[model samples]
Target: MFRSLCTTALLVPLLIVSTTASANPEVDRMFAEQDANRDGVIDQAQARAEATRVFRALDVNRDDERVIAELDPQIASGSPGGDGFPPDIHVVLRQATMQLRDVDGDGRITRAELQQAFVDGLLKADHDGDGKITRAKLIRMHQGVVSPAR
Candidate 1:
């Protein structure tokens, strides 16, 4: 009887954990969206496409690329009068953009540059050192839960 009670106690927590994780509606929706082929895993192509869509959305100028200037509106919108965000935000974005793009430092953002930028940006946004960035993390960053690491 004691052994059975111990097993029940241990399994109860495990079951609760599994149930809680499975109950997250947002995760379920995201999984459905990302599982384009319904294969239950997001392959590289899907990840890349999702990243590309995000990059394009942030590329306010519709120039097919994101530059430091392109992020101004985003920063501004969050700040008073849309005046602009802290200089630090600009500096980080600028340096990150340059590091991702400007491989040649030629002052022009090319297609390759944009691709690299998206990859790098995705990595930066992925907090908790996890390989994947969940919707919660993205929302937290957007809400400034943590200043983005350049």
Candidate 2:
């Protein structure tokens, strides 16, 4: 009984944190964009496509690669004119995107790495073991409630 109480105490905060952390409209928009078919879920292929789109957008020089300088401006813009996400939300997504796409850890994002990162993200968001991620699952992931899909 004591152990159960302690476990419940620990889990309650986590549940609250998870839900609150994911309650951003901009973040929701970004994830929703990945649902290419508009079926309300993001699959691996869709993730790959979105990642590719982001990679291209950030690769301003069109050198087929990205550096911190290239990606920084977009984040710094703070969703200027509502064309992007606010700083708070954009920062997280940008960091995650870079982490996933920078395979060599050399501070550069490549096309191949970008593709893989989205696939990784898809797996991470697919809670309920459903092989697909709904908005709720994405929110749960943001809250840190579930581990990525296998």
For all predicted structures, in order, the TM-scores are 0.42, 0.64
Q: Pick the candidate with the highest lDDT.
A: 2
On residues 1-150, what C-alpha lDDT tens digit does candidate 2 reach at each position?
322222221222223335567355634664556677888777777767766766666566899988765655555443445356766776775675466458889888787876775666556656666667777776776566666336
* Overall lDDT per candidate, in order of appearance: 0.47, 0.60
Residue runs of model 1 more than 4 Å from their true location after superposition: 1-34, 75-85, 101-104, 108-150
| Tens-digit per-residue lDDT, 1-150, candidate 1 | 322222221221122123233344534544454447776544445555644544555555677655545545544454455466588975674565455456777665555555554444444436666555555553444343442464
Measured by TM-score, how close is model 1 to the native structure?
Answer: 0.42
Q: Which lDDT value does model 2 have at 110?
A: 85
Clashing pairs in 2: 18-143, 123-149
lDDT for model 2 comes to: 0.60
Please report how far candidate 1 places residue 149 from its true position, in Å: 20
